[model samples]
Target: MPIRAVVFDFGGVLFDWNPDHLYRQLIPDAEERRRFLSEVCSPAWNLQQDAGRPIAEANAVLVAEHPQHAALIRAFYERWPETLAGLLPEGVALMERLEAAGMPLYGLTNWSAETFPYAWEHYPLLHRFRHIVVSGREKLIKPDPAIYRLLFQRMAQDLPALQPAELVFIDDSQKNADAASALGWHGIHHLDAQTTAARLHALGVDC
Candidate 1:
């Protein structure tokens, strides 16, 4: 089937977001910072918020478990804005090309609902997507087939004839991409903009 639409994953794909951006400044020592990120405000712990857990609740849970690192735990969400460095230029350019070509674009992201507003406000280009399915809003995260199904459901509202195979999903995580592929969508494990563009071209997508 011809690719009819493109679905983008937000964090590592479109936006350059990393807790390390904030942690490096907070804990200057490389080893200390690594430990803090790994043991304290960890990726797994932060994923709960991405899964729709309330920010306050997440912070409280971490704080309770590591009282000594309470301040650091609170800082995770308190300074969440710092984590979003900016948009990836090449990905933005590719999106722009697709938009210009009139290909329907959509966003499927695993981001905290509370922090998403900041990106929505800061990056006007995010408005380019016809619709965005935020995992936090739905209390689901990617790599879970349910979330991908939700995306198809929403897309179907506007494009009733759309089939899973007609969509192409680009994500930084191979696991997430594999999940989309399981449902028959063309999943691009986006490692870089150049590689992603090449893959899209191979799939007969213009951009």
Candidate 2:
């Protein structure tokens, strides 16, 4: 079946997001910054917030565990917007092309609900999506079939109900892509906008 809808992942796929961007300014020293990111405000620790734990509560837990890095931990949420450098122009162009082709667009991202508003406000392009399923708001993360199912359910309400095979899921994470593929959805492990555009064209998307 032809893909009827295109689903996009927000962080690595649409925009660049790295804690290092904010930590480099805060820690200064390369090694210390690396250590702080690895040991203090780690990805695993940050995933808690993405998993729907309130940023304040998550920060408090980290602060209690690493009192010396309390300020740094707090800064993770306080200055979260700094972590999002900017949108990928190539990706933006691809989205524009897809939109022009009349392809329905959707977003699924594992971003902290508390910090997502900053991105939502900063990026007007995000408003173009028909709907966005935020992991934090839903308490579900990618690579989990449940989240993908939720997206399908939500999209089905207003749009024609689509089978998994009729949906094209795009994400920078191979794991997430593979998960969607397992459920019969067409998955694109987006590496670059140019290559992804070609892939979409080959899949008959014409974008």
Candidate 3:
């Protein structure tokens, strides 16, 4: 089926979010920051919060495991806002083009529920979407098939009779895109806004 709606993944696709943005200043030394991020307040550890674990609980667990890095681990969430460098202009422009063209837009993101409020309040563009399914709120992170199914189900409520094939999903992670593809949606493994825009045009999307 021809694509009718677009689902965007937020982190790398829309927001320039990276721990390095915050950690570089805190750790100063590149290797030390790398080790702290990797061996301590790691991506895998942070993902638990994205999966709905409480931030405090997550911090406590990590602190217990790596007492030496307790302060840094706490700072991960304490100074979370510093992690978001800013919005990606090209990505925002693409979303604007799609919205202006009357294409329905939605969002699917694996973000911590505790922190998502900051993004929602600070980023006005996010308010443009018809709806957004946050993995943190749902406790289902990608590339989990269940989260993809939930997105489809939620979209169906608004766009009745929408089919899996009628939707296009854009995500920075190849595996997340592949998961959507497995569910019969057109998945764009978005590396950059230009590439993603080209793919969308090739798929006959309006923008």
Candidate 4:
């Protein structure tokens, strides 16, 4: 089906998304790694933090709630690092082309509330998307059907003609992309932005 809408996952699909890169470079000690990873990255604990809480609030709440890991929690926040690479030229070009072609564009990302804005400070071009959906802002993360549904609803609002097969979503994570597809939306697992953009352009999707 011809794609009337093109949605993208912001992190790895457009820019490099590597938490390990921060850990491996910043924290060389194995013991510190174990401590930080356990308390900070634990899904249950991180969920509260990811859902729009200020980092300080998250830190205090997490530390108080998980007393056993209090010491590690402090280090985790202090050590957390983020990076921003320039948008890939091909990806940027493709997005512009798609915009010019009048295809509705959207973004679905799993970034934490704090992180997304910080990332935005660096990658201002993110403002280009027609509708942007971030899990942190919605208090729901991807791989969960609700987040994808929200994107679908928003896209429908902008491109009233939108239908399942007419939308194309790209994400680096199979789990997330699969979730989008499970909702009957068309999705492509991204390998690399340049190649993926080229392929989409070839398909005449305008991206």
Better of 2 and 4 by TM-score: 2
The lDDT of model 1 is: 0.92
- Residue-wise C-alpha lDDT for candidate 1, range 1-207, written one tens digit per residue: 888899999888889999899988889999999999998888898899999999999988888999998888898889989998998999899899889988999999999999999999999988989999988999999999999999899899888788999999999999999999999999999999999999999889897
Give all candidate RMSDs, comma-separated.
Answer: 0.8, 1.1, 0.8, 3.5
- Candidate 2 residues 1-207, lDDT tens each? 787899999877789899988988999999999999988898898888898999878888888999988888898888888998999888888999999999999999999888888889989999999999999999999889999999999888757766888888889999999999998988899999988888888888978
| Pairs in steric clash, model 3 | none
Better of 2 and 3 by TM-score: 3
Q: lDDT of each prediction vs. the true structure?
A: 0.92, 0.89, 0.92, 0.73
- Cα-based lDDT at residue 96, candidate 3: 90
Candidate 4: which pairs clash? none
Worst 10 residues of 3 by lDDT: 34-43
* Superior by lDDT: candidate 2 or candidate 4: 2
Q: What are the runs in model 1 whose C-alpha is more than 4 Å off?
A: none
Model 1 poorest ten-residue lDDT run: 153-162
Candidate 3 residue lDDT tens string, 45-72: 9899999999999988988898988888
Those runs of model 4 whose alpha carbons end farther than 4 Å from true positions after fitting are 30-48, 51-54, 61-72, 75-97, 198-204
TM-score of each model, paired residue for residue: 0.98, 0.96, 0.98, 0.76
Give the true-structure RMSD of model 4.
3.5
